[model samples]
Target: MPSKADADAAPPLPEPLRVPVADSHTHLDMQSGTVEEGLAKAASVGVTTVVQVGCDIRGSRWAAETAAAYEGVWATVALHPNEAPRIVHGDPDGWSRQGARQGGGDAALDDALAEIDRLAALPQVRGVGETGLDYFRTGPEGKEAQEKSFRAHIEMAKRHGKALVIHDRDAHNDVLRILKEEGAPERTVFHCYSGDAEMARICAENGYFMSFAGNVTFKNAQPLRDALAVAPLELVLVETDAPYLTPAPYRGRPNAPYLIPLTLRAMAEVKGVSEDVLATAVSANTARAFGY
Candidate 1:
């Protein structure tokens, strides 16, 4: 049962997709509903698969367990860029602000990352990320820690033969530099990819997957649309990034995997292709990207 506010925040289900697809990135643990309910709703609308992304040790553990328990869910493990700084500095303020568990200093950061490394090897864990530089949240003080964590996650992904899922925000140059410096995994993805047409071309050149989310449908998101427009269909992936970035006409509403049709439809319109064609490509691309 949902509270009144929760009920109101949730958008009505969009029309079901004619072709099934996978949500390349999402956070089921962050959403309001139970995993079972969320999966059922998503499957009802042709979102037959999802990759549960973890932002911290606890969330990572939950993601691994949930993926192991669920048939259509895979997991990706890593500390968020903002989260890395908090762990390295023993700053409880950030986690406290988010009402999440507090961690310790540099030692704790190492241990936490170790746990993520362990989780990354899980049979159900298909990727190592949502990790990268985030200049938006953490300031200059946190940059070193974020980079260290990002490099380590990249190694973990490669060592485990898993996809490297990136969370690049306002740090595109640094992110690309680090990936090139450390050698990106064979299957690297830009989760909630936020770059321009040039960056999309760069990703295409590198054979990296660019996953677009619901935000691409925003009125002020023409730049994102422009990136999508140039992104090769073979490299394009779709996601809800659920519980955030709900598609337009429902921007303020709480998002769920079930609402993917709206975002995918909007993407097709932008790409000048039919819905079924985009869906087919995205479905196949997601499978190869995540090794599902």
Candidate 2:
């Protein structure tokens, strides 16, 4: 049996987590602060909406509840890679479907397809992801596992006719290829886009909106900022990916959506647009992708 010490390590902090605007992708249910308290801060700072996505079945249920309870909140449901282990290894009967090879519970992927139908009926369920590849960290074995789950998520999004939210970390080429092969949504957004200028151009051509987080403001992210310069206004969005990618100025703190305005200001400066204009554009694009 494994000890508590055997649990996996935590994700590295994304640096200065202050957000001054809407957090396009966040797990409010997983935050240390109470959901209401987290939202209060967001409201105070002028964040208009929050896309609370799930990492699995239970998390997706939490996403639905958060969306239903909060005025400015919306939700999405899908199985994140980290939680994909349950589908193949656990009790097979747990998930509604079969043939997948999981090593553990059907918690995350078990009811994914079923929940896709159920959650879609919810008034506040907006999109279908926080799903995609994470090859940078996942080795060959893990990457293979993540890909199997990813394919299922893409199919689920199609069945529901919802915009697909993607998470790509260091697997741009693989992600781009798979998206090309399976075809991403006609209205899709690369949440926390980390690709460079060239990839940004490709994304623009393919009609994939690129949502930048606080990292764009960092000195090391000239490429991302430059990508922003080339990407059209209609396809650009901003987010904090809060509790993670904290932008500079307030980099070492716990993040919330209210801090998203700072990112908008930075984006506006880079794009040569007004903060109001940028804010409005981001909101509109978010609605378009989310259908809310």
Candidate 3:
């Protein structure tokens, strides 16, 4: 959920860029503004493409529908790691977050994954993720279910020939282990990349994409910048992960796709390259990752 302090309005849009870029992962559905407003704001600032990511079954369906209705937008379908435990245990509170009913048990998990599989076949759905382990939000009780769901999504992405967008938080080793064991999809991205330079080296060796988000702009995020520095330019991507992880100088304020430039500029500085050069590289990387 978004913080209360940053819920009212969006920040001013940054100056438009000559080179266009794509936001590799975002949850427009969870943001403060309407979908059209969000899209317009992004376009006005030259963030021409967006990949709307879903956190659960209902959200995945909505993402696919939104992609079908809008241009310059794509969808990624998945049952988030935190959301997986709720499905396995039939937890009412967790189900409520996704607007799903309780009592369905393991069958519900199967049904949800089946829907995700169906959605993966859509032309507008280009990735399978925001799916990976979340040790911070989900504890030991939920880890097994999360792993099962992660492996399932991995297979789905491979079968559909789409990118795999991972959401790893404090479970980097496990995430890598699972991917190796399951044979990762052709294009794998670590969304909101939360790893060190060594981890970046590991990803680079494996031909995976590392997507840096607004959090990378924080003064305390030196490790993230370090990771960006070591990442191969061809294997790098950028995203807003909007409505959360707003960039510096606007850390407590709302974030939108329009604000992507703030993070991108920060990334360019860290990588010791001009923003335009980094932007062009990131845009091409995103296109290849999602096949857009």
**Winner by TM-score:** 3
Q: After superposition, how far is residue 93 of candidate 2 from its true place, in Å?
A: 19
Q: What is candidate 2's lDDT per residue for 1-292, written digit by digit as tens? A: 4344432222232223233345688877656668887777676667757889876677787898879887888898877665455454464664434333344534434445466557756778877777888866656656765777777777777777777888888889988998888978776779889999999999999999899998898878999999999999988888878777777765655566767777778999999988878877887888787887
How does candidate 2 score on lDDT? Answer: 0.75
For model 3, the stretches where C-alpha displacement exceeds 4 angstroms are: 1-8, 96-104
lDDT of 1 by residue, 1-292 (tens): 5567864677888889989999989999888979999999999999999999999878888999999999999999999998988877767665444333455666677777888999999999999988999999889999988999999999999999999999999999999999999999999999999999999999999999999999999999999999999999999999989899999888877888999999999999999999999999999999999998
Cα lDDT of candidate 3 equals 0.91
lDDT of each: 0.91, 0.75, 0.91
Which whole-number lDDT from 0 to 100 does residue 173 have in model 2?
Answer: 93
Candidate 1 stretches with Cα past 4 Å from truth are 1-7, 93-103
Model 3, 51-108: lDDT tens digits are 9999898889999999999999999999999988888888876665564455746677
lDDT of 3 at 149: 90
The stretch of ten residues in a row with the least summed lDDT in candidate 1 is 94-103
**Residue pairs of candidate 1 with colliding backbone atoms:** none
